[model samples]
Target: MSGHGFHVHGPHDHELEHAQAGEHGGEHGEHSGMINQIALFTAIIATIGAIFGYMGGATQANAGLYKNNAAIRKTEASNQWNFFQAKSTKQSLAELARDLAPEDKKSGYQAKIDRYEKEKNDIKVVADKMELDAMHWEKQSDEQMHQHHRWAQSTTVLQICIALAAISLLTKKKWLEYAMFAAGGVGIIVGVLAALHI
Candidate 1:
């Protein structure tokens, strides 16, 4: 009543509204199958795209992690080598000192030996921990890559079923059409996410 377009309709308006409603209702029922088909097709494409993207990412991460593990192993080996070299040099110096001095030199030479031992032990511990960390990441990356492959396989099966069901709905099968529409909705959600990189 407050709007400029507002008007009180007579009997003619009531008859026209009823006719239009019936027409639209029948048309909607007929077009439901077509709509479901389009939706299901879109979803299948999205699922495929998502699977590819996830697999590609997994492959890249796996390769990178493998390289990282190799580098970490090499570095650990280098640290171990350096530790042994230093230890040997310290022992030779202590031996020389003992040879050139008298009995009083034993106490001071023992301290230098202890210090070198501590340094070597600390280096070994740190290198071991780094190697462990690298191994953990490499394992995790492999598991994730395998998971992506599994998901891709499962989605392919589901996509095939949905596409076939959508086709079946076109033959005046009302129940199948409704089922297809419902299934297609699930596909769309998964497909759109994969397609859009969500």
Candidate 2:
């Protein structure tokens, strides 16, 4: 219509064009928001999985250390028991000598019995303390194992969340996305508990 020789649409046409543009823009925004959220969720899942994996490894190491310490304590306790048995044999022989010896030798044997009794008591105290130490190490090992179990559970859940996230991105299902997020939330909570050694 103008000197440029190009036709311009009427007001009605302009209104229809604007409406279609707005609809398309809205759809694009919605889709982009979903993609952004999925990306963020995937990153969070990967991070949680990594942290829990490290924690699991640390717990395993602690358990092994405790087991080694327990073994050491047990060895020491066994050695003490062997020494205690030797003392017992010496005590029996001393008693037998005291009962059969002359009166002059009897007093010497009595002194030996007294000395042996004191040594046995000392050994008993040391042996009991060593056994208690071994039990403490065993208990610590159990606690580490329990914490490791929690970390393992959290790691599994995080892996599931990651898998679900992958599936969601491919299928673009909002339900699947939400489910992935839910699983990730659970995994995070479990990881926190494990960190707290609960």
Candidate 3:
């Protein structure tokens, strides 16, 4: 009869070693899971933030452009009204000068003519200034709209990159990481180029 269950002397401590290795592997798996969770959470937050940022900037730019357009219209209307008033005043002065007797009209007629001319000149200066100001504001509004559009496009690309990076962490996909990095880098470059007028 075999004293040790019909087996020759086996390698000692083999089962114990296997148990230790299994424990270590479990710990490693748990740590990896934790890391993946953190990565995913961060990416989600970044995506949400990018969306809100893009929305806010776009809204503000559009509102400002609308307000500027309204102001430009108001300035144009005011200038036209000023010109009309000056013309009407000059026509009235001419009629009054014609009604006066010839002997008495000479001095009064000269005074009235000078007054109407000065008033017309003043109104013309105001109209010119208003027109210049309106043009400047319109240019500024256009620039702001362009800037907002660029930012929105860049943000959308960044959001996509963040999502890809999160997936890479979960799956341990090296190619996905590379793709995310490339996309993010391209977006940043394009945004900078647009900003610098390139």
Candidate 4:
């Protein structure tokens, strides 16, 4: 017995497991009004799942929108940086021209260089702002993604609760039914927390 995490099973064992599950699904009919109550509770859980599923979809869409906005801002920032580079090139050329020109023309070249410098600074400020905006949008996308994940978790729990309730109805075991209710309550709490984005 290597006794690792994995185990080997025979084909007969697999069939037995399925046969047992099928038997379980067909069993419970002795309890009074128990199955009906479980069916009602299952309906309620399904409704909650539907609502949270919609919320998850919305949050996912919002996250995508924010991500797209971030990409657009980043593209705009790249364009601004390209403009800044062009201005820098022009300023370098103007400085070279001033160096080669006569003393009388030096002032004109100096003025061009000064204007280019100011333009570069302006472009830099705009590009910096665009970068900041992109980062902000990315942060917003991350937040929405977190909310979406929470909603997904809640929805999954609700699904589990519904499945448990169905199983309880089939088995007609009072203890199992109570367990199903407990699971449903936990699912409700999780759903509410997801709605709160916590």
Candidate 5:
């Protein structure tokens, strides 16, 4: 029999079947119970691991999106700064013209210089605000990347737990079962930390 793409009869399947059919009724019942428990535990852990893996991927995507936003903001700020520089250059030229021009033209050049100054101030404000926005986006990207790592760590731990569960089933080792549960617990704790953005 097969379910969810996995064959029901694994390497130890025959051994378990023999144990279940043996004359030792009490031992057979206990073995069946252990199998059931392990099967249930594996199912639960696999589901949780899948969720953690999805979360990791989502956080990674968010980090990339946020980083892209930061870059765009930085580029916008740079453009603004370049515009401000152009205004400054124009202002300087106007100042030079004001110094050399006739008395009537001097007032016109001075007005141009004043207008450039005001435009530069406005551009500076916008550029500064864009820079701050870029910084904020960068910070958000860093935070999302950190959370992604936590989710990845949690998923890895849960995968290990699943491996331990398989080994315990194959070897009938109680210690391995306990270790599996411990790993599962640690994986869950890490998932919680990721959720909390810790």
Candidate 6:
């Protein structure tokens, strides 16, 4: 009575069958109705749980991607800073050469120093922009990770609700069913928070 990971009769199905057999007409009908209600609730919760699981996975992937992007931007910024340092070193050498050079050669060294200064400034601007971009990407990654956690929380709560539903169905406990519904409501509220990116 099983297909695709689902069983037509669950673990306590034998007990249920025995109880129904011994029950009179109205009692049997009531038991049947309760089973149907739980079945519907379980199905809905399972579906919601699946959706939440997928969202969690997607958000996790996005977080990873954003983190990688941040790393790349940081690397680019480091490279630009290295370029700037190289230019600074060159400019320092040119300044030293200008001080030691003859009067005619000093102008050439001074021109080289000026060119190096301009290039370093440009590199500094690019490096600073890249650093800012890296920070932005890191922030985005953090937000995505937070959302992923929210989705995971929602999914876990829904799983607990589903487990409660199964237990209620097996034990035929009205209180258990009520608890299952309460858990389901909590799960849905968490899911709403996730959707709103709270």
**Judged by TM-score, which candidate is best?**
5
**Which has the better lDDT: candidate 2, or candidate 4?**
2
Across 45-150, the per-residue lDDT of candidate 6 in tens digits comes to: 9999999999999999999999999999999999999999999999999999999999999999999999999999999999999999999999999999999999
Best prediction by lDDT:
5
lDDT of candidate 2 over 92-131, digit per residue (tens): 9999999999998999999999999999999999999999
Worst 10 residues of 5 by lDDT: 20-29
Mind giving the per-residue lDDT tens digits that candidate 5 earns over 30-125? 767788899999999999999999999999999999999999999999999999999999999999999999998999999999999999999999
Cα lDDT tens digits, model 3, 1-198, are 257678444456665665566568765555466556647655654764465456549645775975577597667858666775877677576757756649666677667776776777777777767776777776666666666666666666777777777787778776887777777776666566446534
Candidate 1 lDDT by residue in tens digits, 49-163: 4665566566557657776776777677677768767886887797678677787987788778778777778777776777776677667556655644544544564565466
- Where is model 5 more than 4 Å wrong at Cα? 1-25
lDDT of 6 at 187: 94
lDDT of each candidate versus the true structure: 0.63, 0.91, 0.66, 0.88, 0.96, 0.93
Point out the higher-scoring one by lDDT: 4 or 6.
6
TM-score of 5: 0.87
lDDT of 4 by residue, 81-176 (tens): 999999999999999999999999999999999999999999999999999999999999999999999888888888888878878767666787
The Cα error of candidate 5 at residue 37, in Å, is 0.8
Backbone clash total for model 3 is 0
Off by over 4 Å in 4: 1-30
Candidate 2 local lDDT, residue 113: 94
Cand. 1 TM to true fold: 0.49
TM-score per candidate, in order? Answer: 0.49, 0.86, 0.61, 0.81, 0.87, 0.86
